[model samples]
Target: MKFNYLVFFALCGFLNLSAQEYYFPKANADWEQKSPKTFKIKDAPLQEAVAFAEANEYSGSRDLRIAIVKGFEREPFHQILGRTKKRGGPAGMIIKNGYIVAQWGDTKRVDMTFSVTKSFLSTMAGLAEDEGKIADTKDLVIDYIWDGTFDGAHNSKITWEHLLQQNSAWSGELWGGKDWADRPPSDGDIDDWKLAQPKEPGTVMEYNDVRVNVLAYSLTHVWRKPMPLVLKEKVMDKIGASTTWRWFGYDNAWTEIDGLQMKSVTGGGHSGAGMFISAEDMARFGLLFLNNGKWKNEQLISEKWIKKATTPSTPNANYGYMWWLNQKGDRHWEGLSENIYYAAGFGGNFIVIDKEHDLVVVTRWLEPSKVGEFMTKVNAAF
Candidate 1:
């Protein structure tokens, strides 16, 4: 029995080693064949980077510290151990001047991007406009979604811009309580629910999932196809996203947003969590935007569209078309005249694009934390 137990442990160890050996073959291949190897900061500069990061108020920096302290409890090692405890676990990447500068964590592991997907969806909507698929942002959402449920006076006046800015004025707790992660509206009583419009569009900034859902529904109506299919064909395939990664709608169907039951036009569907991709793939997306929608001379998204999406157009002055505008200032309020914009997810996931610095930083984590301090530190370094 003792001998058998020893043999079993040895086999398990061997299997784990084998899995680790091939953990990032794709990343290795990309390094060797697809692109140049990622640049690494030297030890002296790295120490300064660590110190700067540690002193920041950013949750990502703290999380990185915690991750190190906890010994990385996850998989895909890439950094150093002991001083940080774990090497690489779940990955993140930074791009500057069209080259990958730093990468940490599992470079190949893909995970849910949550609301950062909104930024991409907004980009698609911009494309839809450029292609003449959708007329303009001011177009009435109800014109596209003529479903009987939207007949209420409030719902009739809602526009695509309103949905994009979360100013649709619809009220209901979509992100709280039992329905926190995956709760859909009642289908049987769908028509019975009434949506209230805000006193005026662009006056208020309310972060609601239902508004995004309405955007999804409206886009589907205009495109005459499912959101995921549109995204896959229009964006993902063009970008050459890895086959191991998949973007899901609400549900499982390729055509369905959240499963086949719900449509993308449902309120808050566009803003809340619905899309999934790998960290590296997300970095590619950030790079695309950093390059003004150009990828190696191929314009996947129009430069005009990119500018409008990132530029602020609402009263809040901190939001653009489904993206967050980062201004210069302290923790109290966003200061004036800053050129940074980012797509922020619920937790600590961020794809920050700094036009002034010509840099893009992408990060992902399981915990819900802010990266402001970390951003400040990184920006200061630059």
Candidate 2:
């Protein structure tokens, strides 16, 4: 009887592991869809959330080129420097246990996902750390690039962690985009920002595109290949994303690495180019994160990296490594789990992961302010 009990316990352990397994979609196969009733989710609240998202479509022009210009008119000399696309209408998907429980609009339509690209950029850093290409996030940037980009005393103090957390305070210009000029303080003029002393590294969180591009450029040098190719080979292709997705950089964002010229992709669509991808692909990426960087049997990104990437940074409790945290900060979403984290972009594109419910919510082109309420409704459904 004692031997029988031991065998029963071992079988139970195997069953528990199997229960936690996620369903991974095939590369070209149809994504399996599950009904909301399967999870005992309330139809009214679920439909309400979907309605809110659909009704609150982003106010930006379909011609994103005009919207881009109007959005950042305060910035000096900001223009469409790279590629921009006419955006599609409201689109989204809600994945429960790696299966689509609800989706709206065209999940297959490709659209620009502005700073959501930052999350992807940070993923490259995570990948580099996993492959030992980056020795440590705490290591200084000069140790890798050795370029004049990190030359100044302020920039010299910058580290990989600083950049990842957006607290680098690295003053510089890259691809003709000035750090200060990218998003200057509204209180003061151009000269004030130009001469303003940079904050100490790892002390202040400032959202600047040039600094983000610096990260992309530095990662390019470290990987010894274009970041887009690296992401495709290591991540997207493995996750079965469609070929329609494209990562773009400024026309001037090219660099010669090992006798080969490659474009250093932007971290956002601020000046036009970043990630142009489908909502379906975005959901897949979110599913990977929701599963803690694992895809079926393959651990594509280390679990350690995903944890670090999602953890709140010291300078900004509401921000992680290029990802947004739902902690009680300025950007906290009320009536939702504080543990939630998401990738947000300029025009209300979001890939929210609620681990507590095993939910991956991908919404694009919804009005930014309505997200909290929409999420509140989603949370109520379960």
TM-score on alpha carbons, each prediction:
0.68, 0.96
Task: Write model 1 residue lDDT over 1-382, tens digit each, in one string.
Answer: 2468656876877433322221121232373212222233343443343344333322333333343323322212222211111122334665655456556666577555557878877876887988988788888876766765256776677777877877766433322211111222335342222332245656766665545655665677667776667777776666666666554444321223333444442221132226556777777777677777766546788888887786676566678888888643222123322778888874456788876656667776633333664565455444
In candidate 2, what are the lDDT values of residues 1-382, reduced to their tens digit? 2468656876877443432657888998899998899888888899989999999999989899998999999998788899999999999999988888899999999999999999999999999999999988999999898869899777888999999999998887889988888787778678988888989999999998889999999999999999999999999999999999999999989999999989999999999999999999999999999888988878899999989998999989999899999999999988789989999998999999998888999999999988998899999998
Model 1 ranges with Cα > 4 A deviation = 1-90, 171-199, 251-273, 328-337, 366-370
Clashing pairs in 2: none
lDDT at residue 277 of model 2 (Cα atoms): 96
lDDT of 1 at 278: 71
In model 1, how large is the Cα lDDT of residue 1? 25
Model 2 misplaced regions, further than 4 Å: 2-19
